[model samples]
Target: MKIRVNNDASYIRVFNATANSDKIDVYINDVLVFSDVRYREFVPYTPTFPGDYTVKVYECGNSEKLILEQELTIAGGNVGTLVITGIMPKLMLLAVFEDPNEKTCESNAKFRIAHLSPTTEPIDLTVNGVKMIDEIPFGKRTNYAEVPIGVYDFTIEESNVESEERNDGIRISKKIELKDNKIYTIYLIGDVPDIEIIQSLDIITYMNK
Candidate 1:
């Protein structure tokens, strides 16, 4: 099982995405499994025996009040992600099933895009002025695309925008360098105008051998 927090940690805003930004402790089946997990970070693909478990989240040193709790099932050779989201008092847990088998070569980098902005409209992604993906709605993710290691320009635009209104569309742009042999997840999050582009690297240290 893997754990991650995508809660927005942006500067002094009108309201924060999570109840607090302090580190949290994760408990599985009433036992501590992870500690001090910060925002936008994750524990990737940690192995676990197949079984049923209860996942609970609590403030670092206090277990009196649980922020979130959910039932989890770990089947043989299965991979999954436990995501924490929403603001305090309304915090929620989301589980995602992941593909365990990934065919990756050493010559290029692999990347996938995730549209996580709840209030944002579907978007079209372009790389160096070339369209890579179209009409990706919020809360959805795409399959990985392999590309040579190099710097590339990225732009995100509303999917249904008119040609004449392109200049005033909700366009977000950035440039990034992708390293070879690495896997990345580029996610769009937060509300418009204050949105953030998060590029997370997947580092696999061990696998069944």
Candidate 2:
């Protein structure tokens, strides 16, 4: 006898001893699908979801019933990538906008930037050995500024320079020569600014206003 089942899950087929045998016993699961037993071969009955199923064959002499069986299953599959959203990080852009009018800090608006660490774990920043802000919120941006004199590279959190990927992070800003007397204003560019949290040392202009 020969039998075959399809992955499409449509149905199962059963066959018997000789090429002429047409009887069959078809079952979807263990339950008999047909009301009557087939002699030579059989065809499946109902439609079903993807899962294991059993098929059986039966032969009855006047006293006992004989049985044959098979198992089957149906299936479907799916796959894709991942996307994420959160707060922004600080970005340092280099720019020279001589506009004296744009000197004040704009508190109403805040921008975000994402800085990647050269190393996985947070870098223990030391500018002559000092501790800065320890927690850098990734994918998010936020900052507050207050400073005086000299160009600063390693950002000072409280008493130290800490490395971070957050808004208050190390950024290569426009090389502004922090002149002793003159004030410089910073402006952002692009629908999507090359950098997010832009900082400028235009204190003289801001104070005069």
Candidate 3:
């Protein structure tokens, strides 16, 4: 939370983390104030006449350490865009090849990508620098596929196939960041009904579903 404090007084506010997770530390003006190896979703804390304060969050557990520092400045007045909470830096996106071996998609499967970015609309959902698809079927034949990102270079996948003889046919490639509270989908239609899932990831990281 960002705050603006004036006068020689202290301001009290709630400060909490996921606790016992991202061991957090509190500091004001580069002066260390408090540190907790626990998680508190909304614990209270007081900052003394702060000019510029920061909340440093560090990752704990047997895994690697992830450090995040958020800045806050105090003034006699309120600051604009002072994000209170509910802001996520990263999120998980599920990419599924719907019914890879199903009869509805025996030859080719339709794709429908939806980016649940606060709404049904997307930030940037473009294909081949063209317009967007109105809708895609969910599960039935010629149905749309679901995805997370909007900007897709399906031709990149096409090029991958043309440049090399791929048994799976046309391929697609895209790189987009996933937003929290959003679901992206893709609608696809082809001659082949069955969808074949092929994962060639060099590194496999298991996520705790």
Candidate 4:
């Protein structure tokens, strides 16, 4: 799958969410950027100049077999993530970006959900029993929402399920703490009945400067 963005000076990284893929290498404009990236792993953000470029992914050590090729544009002073998702023979690239204009204060945090589970039903995310994100389907990502910095219970439930029938439809339940001025992505990965929740910090490099 290919993705095109408007050009800028950006910080980008790669996440391997392909449940059935082997270790891979990622190249930006033919230059190796991430190598030996295993499933469920993340390659940290790297700086890039503002421009358009090609992104190619290959099975580790096999340049002759191209797995996927995509087009990316670096947005100046922003941060983004390029995700490799889905099973082989039907792989895709998903671009998730942080809004550079949404400023955060020291008393609050920001978070969003990324649904990467290839076979799971559309779902809802509840934080401490309050619905925060709703009806997010496979391969869809939600925009960041601000919340007070604190510990909370996060639950993932199949969307549209009756409240009384939620026991069996619940997919993930976990507790997480959010810190002041931080950003997070809650990733729902793996296949149904065997799902996993991965919480990762999203650092906006341009803001750190």
True-structure Cα RMSD, model 4: 4.7
Residues 1-209 of candidate 4 have per-residue lDDT tens digits of 21222345566889998888899999889998889999889988776777788999999999998999988776576577889988786788888887655556778888889999887889999999898888999988898888899999999988978888877785689998988888788899876677888889886512632
- Model 1, span 80-125: residue lDDT tens: 4556655554556654444545545777787787776655689889
Query: Model 2 residue 131 lDDT?
Result: 36
Q: What lDDT tens digits, residue by residue, belong to model 2 across residues 34-124?
A: 5344322222323344566565444322112424444544342100000011111211211111222223233222111222221122222
Kindly give the stretch of ten consecutive residues in candidate 4 with the minimal lDDT sum.
Answer: 1-10
Separate clash counts for every candidate: 0, 18, 42, 4
Which pairs clash in the backbone of model 4?
A: 8-50, 8-74, 8-76, 9-76
Score residue 7 of candidate 4 by CA lDDT: 45
Ranking under TM-score, best-scoring first? Answer: 4, 1, 3, 2
* Winning model by lDDT: 4
Error of 3 at 123 (Å): 21
- Candidate 3 stretches greater than 4 Å from native: 1-6, 17-20, 41-43, 60-66, 76-209
CA RMSD of each candidate after superposition: 7.7, 29.9, 18.2, 4.7
The Cα RMSD of model 2 versus the native structure comes to: 29.9
The TM-scores, one per candidate, come to 0.74, 0.23, 0.28, 0.87
Lowest summed lDDT window (length 10), candidate 2: 78-87
